[model samples]
Target: MRATSRFLLIGLASLALAAPVSGQRSDDQILPKSAELQKQGRALYSAGKLTEAEDLFETALAVDPRNRGAFVDLARVAEKQHLFGKAIRMTNKALQLEPNDADAIAIQGEAMVELGAVARAQQNLQKLQTICRQGCPQVAQLSAAITRGPTVASAKTPETPKTN
Candidate 1:
């Protein structure tokens, strides 16, 4: 009986091990509901309703964590709010979902420039160049952002009150 039980346990273990592992969904496999939310967010964004757009983008991400486009849209809203760090982080999430995503790379580079990380932005620009040898719009966008340089506020120092 003991031997039979041990054999059964081994068989069960083997069966469990043999079960197919679920692989990650591809970048294009976002759920329809999530995609719809992302579309609504984009329309709101275009309408200049950044807060509403950001909420919709966040909801889209909640619906499907793999929605890279929603992450990119959130990054755009963060950029509009002058939240460069948040934008970079959001773009990083999108990049993780699709490493070669041109929009994510370009947005990240732009945020880096806003944060005065010109060197890092240049690296992103170079990466975009390599990814889109045929010359995509992302390449031009990042290139123009690099040329435009960091914002004046990023370079300015806070004025200290005069000491008596």
Candidate 2:
């Protein structure tokens, strides 16, 4: 069997096994205030106001510490600020809450690449491969990031001393 097909079957089986019991809370439940804050944070982020977005995301987390959405948004803001470590950590926190979160996995992979953790990044890519099917956008995005490599800032040349 093709690896992709096998992976798909395994993923399906895992999902089946992980399916919540009837008495368990559904994933759809969300605190209204936290949801509103997350929405506002996303809007700010899209508008390039990363600082404001970060603040809103933090507020959301304060309101509902279990909100993986807030952690994911905070990861994005950290990435925008070039704080790759923070981004990875925040993504991890989100992943801890929701292991199959595509956004968190994708962002964490991107952060690993930025931090020059190629092996770890590859691991995340593999996880994505398992989590997403062929042609999935998250997989495509992480693949592109791995191919593109880390972005390096240009070093400024020092000024030469003037001759008398």
Candidate 3:
């Protein structure tokens, strides 16, 4: 009877070890928040409430320091506020966590464009082309930004009228 009980205990232990936990993410996955802070932050960001969105994203990060989504959203907030340097820094952190993060890469390219680093922005454009060879919104967006950039600059300069 003692041997049978020991075997039952071992079987129970094996079954417990094989069970998958429902609430926690795997190590290689992005850390999801226990609350909906990240989701709410994204909504605020979409509504252009940058300050509020930033606060919520920061709160989410405080809870999950490794939250890649929070880092990406914070980068978007910085970009919308024209804080190009801060955007680049935040996106870099997200990229470190997820090397192939499309949103982070796109935001990095946008930040580079605003900083007048056209050459570096092209690098990201090229990467997006390779990642989404079939074409993607990010590639189109970056291409448009690069194309319209020179026109915007030219418009800023007053053109002298030629004599008739």
Candidate 4:
């Protein structure tokens, strides 16, 4: 995760840690009101509400189909659920919309790696580094992972968030 997303995850972790979690996020980036739904989805995801989070993410996407963030997040949740095929499809949707989005590309790479398509995974991860944001370190980690190949060890944490 990037610093911002990591910070968000830390917040989420505090939320989840008290209960139980886990991203890269942008700073100085103002997401639209549609983020409310995304926030709900993340909270639900942290809460171990995979199905619910999936539904909320779907709803968020419906409300803003162009929101690549939701697609990437949804794909991640699906990946955690061991729904590799679904993850692939969802990430594909994100990639289709934001072909050059570094986060989306990096996530797609991770998904591809999970789906056993190492080449494709490497391709996407490389793209992420090539288009990385300033001061974000998750991109490096992701790129490193791609270079290192699959981990086979899941680092998935809990999905309720800590109250903000």
Candidate 5:
């Protein structure tokens, strides 16, 4: 009876470990409510209501943290806010969900460019090229951003007055 109980305990433990793996959602399985929230967020973003859009995007993520589109949209909002580092981090989350996401790579590249990380942006561009060999709008967008270079505000530093 002792040996049987031990075997049953081990089996239950293994099954518990596997339960989470089974519960994990696939990349294609975004929650519908999250998608709806993301749609609303996109409309708000397009209408120049960035704060409202950000709120909706955050809600979408709360509903479904795996909503890769929401992550990408949040990154766009961050870029608009001139929060380049946050934008990069948001795109990194989307990339984690789908490594071949051209939009995420492009957005991340643009944010990197804004931060004056040209070399890293170039690498992201290369990755986009590899992922979209047939050519894509993201490729063009990222290329244009690279050509534009970093914003003047990002490049400039305030000068301090020298004390006698």
Candidate 6:
């Protein structure tokens, strides 16, 4: 399994240098190096190097300003760092660029849950769950968190419930 994973990693690294998609305007084209940097940023994010990931993501954005992936990535790193306002801002920026972005919506929804905006989080989660055609497993986790959070935080006992 380790060898197979290594081989797949090398193969993906090679493919990261492939040409940009057609129909992308010249200004919107993501160069191979930027794509590689973005991939590296994601790896760093997954490894919990939020500061390093944010730096690499910013570098990728400097190379390609219109990269929605960078914005989503930045939001996630910020969220991991507990910078909810920054996360929310970045998520909003990503949504403006790609309004139907399930990933961005999900990120915002998760952030809202943390920020105690229960109803708003529920609304965004609902939107994400609806359009998430291919079974968003992460959204499932978020759904569980949202449902469990209040139950855990709420006091179950009533003040007048003492029985004689």
**Best candidate, TM-score:** 5
Q: What tens-digit string does per-residue lDDT give for candidate 1 at 1-164?
A: 99999999999998877665445566689999999999999999999999999999999999999999999999999999989999999999999989999999999999999888999999999999999999999999999999998775656899999999
TM-score of each: 0.83, 0.77, 0.72, 0.64, 0.84, 0.69
Tens digits of per-residue lDDT, candidate 3, 1-164, equal: 99999999999998887776655666455455623788999999989899999999999889877788888899989977778899999999999988878888888988887778889989998998899889889888888877655333344778799998
What are the candidates' C-alpha RMSDs? 3.8, 11.6, 8.7, 20.5, 3.2, 16.6
Compared with the true structure, what per-residue lDDT tens digits does model 6 show for residues 111-158? Answer: 777778879888887887788867686578668757765332254565
Candidate 3 Cα outliers beyond 4 Å, as residue runs: 1-35, 150-164
Estimate, for each residue in 1-164, the C-alpha lDDT of model 4 and write its tens digit.
48999899889878876652124334224256657898999999999989999888888888777677888889889778767677778878877876776666666667677666888877766666667646356577566767766555455555768796
lDDT of 5 by residue, 47-151 (tens): 999999999999999999999999999999999999999999999999999999999999999999988899999999999999999999999999999999998
Question: Model 6 — which ten-residue stretch has the worst lDDT?
Answer: 149-158
Local accuracy by lDDT, each model: 0.93, 0.88, 0.83, 0.73, 0.94, 0.80
- Over 1-164, each residue of candidate 2 has an lDDT whose tens digit, in order, gives 69999999999988888776655654557689999999999999999999999999999999888889899999989998999999999999998889989899999999889888878989988999998876478888888888888864323366899999
lDDT, residue 149, model 4: 63
Give the C-alpha miss distance for residue 150 in model 5, angstroms.
Answer: 0.9
Backbone collisions counted per model = 0, 0, 0, 11, 0, 0
Candidate 3, poorest ten consecutive residues by summed lDDT:
146-155
Residue 47 in model 1: lDDT: 99
Ranking by TM-score: 5, 1, 2, 3, 6, 4
